[model samples]
Target: MEHIPHGSPDDPNPLRRLSLEQLRRRTSIKWRAYPEDVLPLWVAEMDVPLAGPVARAVTDAVALGDTGYPAGTGYAEALASFASERWGWDTLAVERTRLVSDVMTGVVEVLKLITSPGDAVVVNCPVYQPFYLFVEHMGRRIVEAPLDERARIDPGGLEDAFRRAVRGGHRAVYLLCSPHNPTGTVHTTGELAAVAALAARHGVRVVADEIHAPVVSRSARFVPYLSVAGAESGFSLMSASKAWNLAGLKAALVTAGPAAAGDLARMPPEVGHGPSHLGVIAHTAAYRDGGDWLDALLGGLDENRSLLAALLAEHLPGVRHLPGEGTYLAWLDFRALGLGDDPAAVLLERGRVALHPGPPCGTGGAGHARLNLATSPGILTEAVRRMAAAL
Candidate 1:
């Protein structure tokens, strides 16, 4: 790497090369269907290398051969410390913090521990999808409370859902997502507080999935459920895995109120004993020293965001997207394209770009597509180009 003078990177042609191409050339996986050169905008991992701190930690842990059956361990301490340092909130002590195979497992286990069959669990549509499956798989009835057009959470709608559930003699549980998955809407503290009040009134249990809390946008504020006034009486699901792009490492933290945590703790030893030991090393590394890399990565994302907006307008004018306030995911409206109401199939298969269709995200996501901007700028540009050509 040569020392290039630090100057305006906004010049149409920036100094040096983009890491996006490096990742693309390195990726041996065939993303698009045969015969199609794929430009994958799917999966949550960043195309760039892991943060130096996290990288060093993972490497050192590997050197130490820390892999083992991470049943009862220091993993909790690592997660709690991370929470205290980053979020400024004292998460339940490590002893109180339970581990799971990963985030999806935590969400599933939490839902089952509280709600019963036929009970109403409130979910904002176009959710992470696993929530719906978790509820349905657990035999709980789903209370559909969809997000508004802006992708911002609708507290009033949520309260209405809670009110309706209580009246129907159905137990209500809230599956919350902040700095949401596909749409990337970071729920405001006030909105979350309003929802919390409504749920408390209806005796609803709130299971907040805040995995994306760490990558918050510069102008946005992402408040963890437990950080909210009523969160001590709530459930918070978070982990360092998402923030560090270590999802494959497999570990997440689940904390809830006393009674709830105790009840949750006893369900099965398997629930808490499922986290990966490697993930623990990565978690600690990321929380303790990855801030610098994260900031630089965010800067890259900001540029990519601007590039995406400009590129879409100039080339793929048919595709519409909200400058994602937070999260690497970008939600695009593709209805304007001649591809009719939805263009994911046409884009992914015909256009050779893998885009998560919006309908699966829920009603608000309909006629929409979710693009992961976590990759390199060049890759994003190519993705947009391919999508434009397909349209």
Candidate 2:
């Protein structure tokens, strides 16, 4: 797609075009060791800014000064439009959609609405750090199901975990991540179908997080949990934030199920009805007409991913390379760095690179540092170069 030029805003830092030098400079977490010379491949935000169409939309909204509270508007309808275009599922009925603050909010709300305190919620390990916290923070019990090596979903292990949870009198829901995070292994249709089927029979709800759905690898297209037979019977939490880099904008689409997404509708006729209006406007712009920009962004990420993999193979030999199946987050096994289990701390203290300390993701996460590869290829290469030097 030809670049569409959205007139620039008058900000000192209007996120526009991406440059390797600029990306390297921009994303380096400030105040970390390694001085100005070190590169930081941490942080999930993409180096590329919003697409022109998206930029124009937000600019237009700002121009028209329609930045009021997004309440009671047809936010659901807009989200449905996006779902239809991307997923080939024509979700024409927007009534089932509710705009939450963000994907985390949706996940927390779904858990809160469906399961009571002390009820066990299942989550795969080495996941987004928030997964563990979300369950515990809600006073709910957590069922840990760690992913196998290569980071793919271990179906047998998952089923076993669920069975144990059920047998223990702790039956509830699964906090599922599509295009699985950290490792980026997108779920196979067969695997997802099996998960849904199992949850359905055992009366377990599957709250699928589809925030990173847009930038999936070409070999892997993200299939929404609700698209599966048993998913809508459960619930889905989606947002345009990760796809379009509007997380700070705070817009998310949640499909709560069955009779109007089940959970959201059953709320005593007086609950679960609030969404950010700013998110609504930004989200609609992303879903309806942000396809071309998304394609370009994916193209950039694809290049960056290859660059990183090659660097790891060549320079950082012995670092376990968990294949990136979907998202741009590359789980680098730094165990070979031989800095004990906490390479993340060593990286920060000695290596001087600010990485997401791997331990927080639980169990298997110990030796793994999740490196965000959603930057320009130049930046990724330099980041790897710096990291290799540090090691």
Taken over the whole model, the C-alpha lDDT of each candidate is 0.71, 0.72
What does candidate 1 score on TM? 0.88
Q: Estimate each model's TM-score.
A: 0.88, 0.88
Candidate 2 residue runs with Cα over 4 Å from true position: 1-16, 19-38, 72-74, 267-274
Specify the poorest-scoring 10-residue window by lDDT in model 2: 6-15
List pairs with backbone clashes in candidate 2: 70-277, 256-261, 257-261, 257-262
Error of 1 at 326 (Å): 1.8
Poorest 10 consecutive residues by lDDT, candidate 1: 1-10
Q: Per-residue CA lDDT of candidate 2, range 1-391, in tens?
A: 1122321333212223555344445433332333554455666776666667778877898889987776664556766766777777674356776667788877877777777887888888888888888778999877878888767778777877787667667657888888788888888777788898888777777888878888687766777767766555667777788888886677776786663365676544323335556667778877877887787677767766777778988989978886676777888888776877778777666555667678888878877788887655555666676678778
